[model samples]
Target: MDGRPMTFAKMLEETYTDGIAVLHRGKLIYERYFGALKPHKPHIGMSVTKSFTGVLAGILVTEGKIDPQAPVTDYVPELKASAFGDARVHEVMDMTTGLEYTEVYTDRNSHVWGLRRANGMAPIPPNYDGPTTIFDFLVAQKKQGEHGKAFAYKTVNTDVLAWICRRASGLTLSDLLSERIWTQIGAEEDAHYHVDRIGTESGGGGLSTTLRDLARFGETMRNHGRFNGRQIVPSSVVEDISRGGDPEKFKPAGYTTLPGASYRNQWWVTHNPHGAYMARGVHGQGIYVDPKAEMVIARYASHPVAGNAANDPVTLPAYMALAKALIAGG
Candidate 1:
């Protein structure tokens, strides 16, 4: 550690992180555990799981098992009457679906919470008659704006994509991920997903894995979908995610924390010279990959704030600094 001490222990103490892992040039540079997190423990990935789902969809497309331009209704015909019925698989993958649901986490009655209830993460009321499953919740969504016109962050869109992955691959999300990604990449341990009553993986935000394994995934992406001597995911898939979607569409989303950032295939693109990208989750879960610098950072935290907006001020700068240090040292 020749650079200024950004040790994992110090990061945990300073950022209230549950776990932190850093990989530079595909080697573990630092790792630490805090607040009951263990090497084998699997903490919820939250929206970070969205990236996994997106990548899986990409793999399916590469294998000729799916077509991104196809209508989502082709896979989940039951959604034909819903807002997502006309949505393209690529639109959902890019989060350009124009759904009426709001993602305001501060509000108890927000549509995101309703999704949590439907996905079985939150307890439902006794007399609740809304959608009982994630699929149902998505099918019941109302159209708010035209699809493919703007970037709108909606969890239900990912859930619908997950369902498509399941239907297309003829396997559950967990099985598909394990077979296509986790095991192939030599994951340190088996990751698990929280399931609903009928055993549907939450898809939108329910997978969990240890910091080390998460770092491995980040490194895999940094390597353009190759890992552990295998092309676990097609290079084209990674290129699409790294290239990112239109910044103009992203501007309307109003992510003040990420100026000049774009979203594509469930990954957040910084569009900086280093070609940095990230998989982020609510409440401070992040996997930051800087391909030019050959650095990957996996962090899990239970920050007081629910959205990344609050943490980005400190985290974004810190990551850029760390990447610069790594590049200089190299």
Candidate 2:
């Protein structure tokens, strides 16, 4: 140890992490809970939900129910007038839709607020009435630029993919997830999502799951889709995400903390030596997978800041350091 006071403990304090579970070589090496969170309760997964959406998309694709190159209108005709109408399914999965939507959370009138209002996360004003359902808000989106030319971080892309998943599978995102992954993963508790007025799951950012279950998913991903003596997620899907998406496309997004990383199927691919990647949510939720070190970290936090920009510096370094320690000391 480099005289750096046990890094992970420091990170827990600095990031206001609610719970953390670390798995090394398929074993629980470290586990703890803080604040109001417990082992049994499901904490909000935030944008981590997008990663879940991505996994479901992979399942649908493997089942031959989804066509990545197909236009969004192939499934959701309501989006035919929206920007996504011209976009491919994979484009939405990769967030290259080129929509005019803004995700600036601090702004009162940002598109994110409108999304929150539709999904039951924000308070609806008595006198205001716009799109109250997720479907309505999505169809209202229009094009801003050329699709497939540049990567943009937009939550609505995941929502569109969720709708497409429903159309392709004839199953709601919740039910499809329950059938395809959750039950097979040996999750300790049932997970859920926040829904809209029409009971549509907010696939963009509304999942909730226990820290242990999150770790189970992470470990499954680390093992390339195998868990609990079965193939929970397809190995091909894991390989695609592990191989990563195009960095050239991801470069223009300019995430300061994620330099040289690509967004693929809603997962952030870190082109680091460890070949690390993460499913990240705003407010510090994550499933950091380091294939080289055979390690997976599942964390749920309520940091005062929403973006990982605040948490990544402290959390990422700590994770790498711990991975090194586990690998070398073993």
Candidate 2 residue pairs in backbone clash: 283-306
lDDT of each: 0.89, 0.92
Model 1, range 1-330, lDDT digits (tens) per residue? Answer: 224556534545666689888999899988888889999998889999999999999999998999999999999999999998788999999989888899999998999989988889889898988777786788799988899999988888889989999999999999999899998988878898988878899888999998899999999999998898888889999999999889999999899888899999899999988889999999899999998899999999998888988778667778888899898987
| Winner by lDDT | 2
Provide the lDDT at 306 for model 1: 88
Q: Show model 1 residue runs off by greater than 4 Å.
A: 1-14
Task: Let me know the TM-score candidate 1 reaches against the reference structure.
Answer: 0.96
Q: List model 2 lDDT by residue over 1-330, tens digit each.
A: 234665568879989999999999899999999989999999999999999899999989998999999998999999988888788999999998888999997798889999899888997899987889899999999899899998999999999999999999999999999999999998999999899998999999999999999999999999999998899899999989988899999998888888899989999999999999999999999999999899999999999888889998888889999889888987
**Residue 303 lDDT (model 1):** 88
Query: What's every prediction's RMSD, in angstroms?
Result: 2.8, 1.8
